[model samples]
Target: MTKAQIRQTYDRIAHWYDLIEAIPEFLGVKILRRELLQRASGKVLEVAAGTGKNLRYYPKTCQITAADMSSAMLEIARSRADGLGLDITFLIMDAEALGLHDQSFDTVVSSLTLCTFPDPVAAILEMARVCRSNGRILLVEHGRSDRERLGRWQDRRAERHAARVGCHWNREPLKIVLKAGLKVIDARRAFFGIFHLIEAMS
Candidate 1:
């Protein structure tokens, strides 16, 4: 989809997105934010930061720039940031084509977001491109199952579900990060191997 179309699609879904995605989404965000906090330091860039769900978990001393493609989602994020008194810069930006300068941030974070990108590989490469050489990039995503049967099921359902909900279920995000030239420093699979926490160095 074009960027405009993607934005509109997400905007239309913004209000209902959190409500419909409450359970696994909440748990996943919680897990990811905790993991990110352990390694996060210095200036951070959070891509596709829908509704700023990860904002509260960030340390008060850290500076954060949160970006999302959808304006509606960002509107909600801005309100949440203001309500929490968290100083954050919110921008309407694309993941594949970040407008920031190279090596701009010490840490890059994406929580359950890679799977929704039309070109996840390019998005990840951009994350690495905008991160300092020693910076860490953390991701928590749901991917294709390791089990043959479940993997096949995800493969069969992913495209249709993606079409309906703007999310992909079968993305191999860990492999994509490695392919983007980041070195994997740590990885853990949870929720019956459906969810993953990956820490990579640029």
Candidate 2:
């Protein structure tokens, strides 16, 4: 999808996104976000920080810069930050082309966002690029399940799902990490191998 389409699609769904998240099916997602964000430290940047779902999980001592392409989404994130009494810097930015400095953050993070980027590799590279040499790139994401039957099901509905939700649910997070040449510090999976929690060094 074109950048405009992506921004527009997410903008339209920004409000509903959190509502859908409230469904019981997504409890695991919240658990994953909390588990990953708990590790964030020092200067942190969260790309595509949709609705600031990871905001409350941030450490009070950490400085956070939350970014996203959709302005509407960022608005929601800003409000969430305010309600949580967290001082966060919010910016509207395209994940593929972040307007941030290189090697500036001590920790770079993104959750459940890679699968939607039109160029997932470029996005991963951007995350790696902004992280300092010793900084970490942490992510908690869901992708194609290891099960063959589910893999086939994802393949069959991938196109339609992407068109509607602006995400490719069947992507392989490990492959994208490898393509980015990130040094894997740790990696694990949950939900029968559908959710990947990866921590890699830049």
Candidate 3:
């Protein structure tokens, strides 16, 4: 999907996205966010920080800058931050092209977002570029399952899923992470190998 398409799709879903995702089938995702996000510290930048779902997982001492392209989505994220009394700076920016200075953050994060980025490679490169030397890059993403049956299910529904949710269900997150040249520190899979949790260094 084009950036405009993604923006519009997210804008339309902003009001109900969280509610929809909170269904029983996805409740485990909240736990995944907490576990994946605990690795973050110091100055942090989060790309495609949707609805601030990960806001509560940050350490109190960490400074956070959350960026998302959709204005409507950012509004909910801002509200979530405010409600949590978390001092977070929210930016309306694209992940593929960030406006921030180089090596500005100690850690960079992107969660459940890589698949939606129009240029996942470019976005990963941008994440690596703004991270300080040896800084951590943490990502909690979902992708094609290693299990054949589930993989086939994802393959069949990938395009339709993208059309409805702005997410590419079949893209492997590690491929783009490596393609961007970030050094992997730790990597694992869970939820039947569909969810990828990664910790890397820039």
lDDT per residue for candidate 1 within 1-202, as digits (tens), equals 5567778888998888778768876656577668666677789999999888888887778799999989999998898999999889998899999999999999998988877888899999999999999998988788897887998999999889888777788988888888888899999887767788999987
**Candidate 3: misplaced stretches above 4 Å?**
24-27
Q: Global CA lDDT of candidate 2, please?
A: 0.88
Candidate 3 per-residue lDDT, tens place, 4-40, comes to: 9999989999999888768522746667788878889
Candidate 1: pairs in clash: none
Which candidate, 1 or 3, would have the higher TM-score against the true structure?
Answer: 3
Better of 1 and 3 by lDDT: 3
- Estimate the TM-score for candidate 3: 0.96
- Candidate 1 stretches with Cα past 4 Å from truth are 26-29
Alpha carbon deviation, residue 33, candidate 2 (Å): 1.0
The TM-score that candidate 2 achieves is 0.96
TM-score versus the correct structure, for each prediction? 0.94, 0.96, 0.96
Per-residue lDDT of model 2, residues 1-202, tens digit only: 7779989988998899888767523747778778888889999999999889889988889999999989998999999999999999988888888888999999999988888899999999999989999998999888998988988899899999998877898999988999889999888888777888899987
lDDT of model 3, residue 16:
91
